[model samples]
Target: MIKIKIISSKETYSVRQPVLRAGKPIESCLFDGDDLETTKHFGLYFDENLVGVVSVFENKSNNFHDEYQMQIRGMAVLEEYQKKGLGNFLINQTEEYAKFQNASLLWFNARETAVAFYEKLNYTIIGSAFEIQNIGIHYVMYKHL
Candidate 1:
């Protein structure tokens, strides 16, 4: 069985490094605000091994008028576990957490390749695509709670 639960920012680095950073150093997986008191990290465990990870931060975007907003960062699932509904499950849990925190919306700089995935979840793209150094193109995507 697969279980999704809250985990420490440090714990998320394992999956984040391998799946998101890939060729980059493990330290690159450490995102800003990851250890903040209001930040939350989630891990997807299959049996006893973590296979996916995601982190959310209490961040506000000028593009959004919501009083409370959350940003999702460093979301990644193991390659072998991709397309098995795990991504959807993680996202659903994150949305619930956001709502619990009184956040009216959730946003993220989603990679260009993942745009369709977020769109399928009812998130709309904002502004044009842009590059982030070594990372490929990305677009700001958001969903209102």
Candidate 2:
């Protein structure tokens, strides 16, 4: 069985390092607002071991005029767990959590390769893809709550 639970930011670093920041500095796993009271990190456990993770911040982008917004950052599942629909479950859980906070919209900088995955979840790309320093191309995607 798989379980989703609210985990600390530090707990997410373990998965983030290998999946999202592989070959990069460990500092790359640390994100702004990660420790904020409004921020939340979630972990998905398969059986008794954590296998996937995602972090959400109560941050609003100037590009969006929503009264309340949240941004998703560092969402990833272990390579061994890919193609098992775990990502969809993790994202959907985060969306429900955002709604409880009265969020009007949810946005994130999605990697180019992950665009289709977000699209399948009904998230639309805002503008053209842009580069994020060390990271590759990314597009701003959002979904209305």
For each candidate in turn, give its C-alpha RMSD to the true structure in angstroms. 0.7, 0.8
Give each model's whole-structure lDDT: 0.92, 0.94
Q: Considering every candidate listed, which one attains the maximal lDDT?
A: 2
Instruction: Tell me the tens digit of each residue's lDDT in model 1 across 105-131.
Output: 999999998998889999999999999
Give one digit per residue, the lDDT tens place, for model 2 in 44-120.
Answer: 99997889999999898988999899999999999999889999999999999999989999999999989999999
> Which segments of candidate 1 are over 4 A away from where they belong?
none
Model 1 residue 19 CA deviation in Å: 1.5
TM-score of each: 0.97, 0.97
Residue pairs that clash (backbone atoms under 3 angstroms), model 2: none
lDDT of 1: 0.92
Q: Evaluate model 1: give its TM-score.
A: 0.97
- Give the least accurate 10-residue stretch of model 1, judged by summed lDDT: 13-22
lDDT of 2 at 80: 97
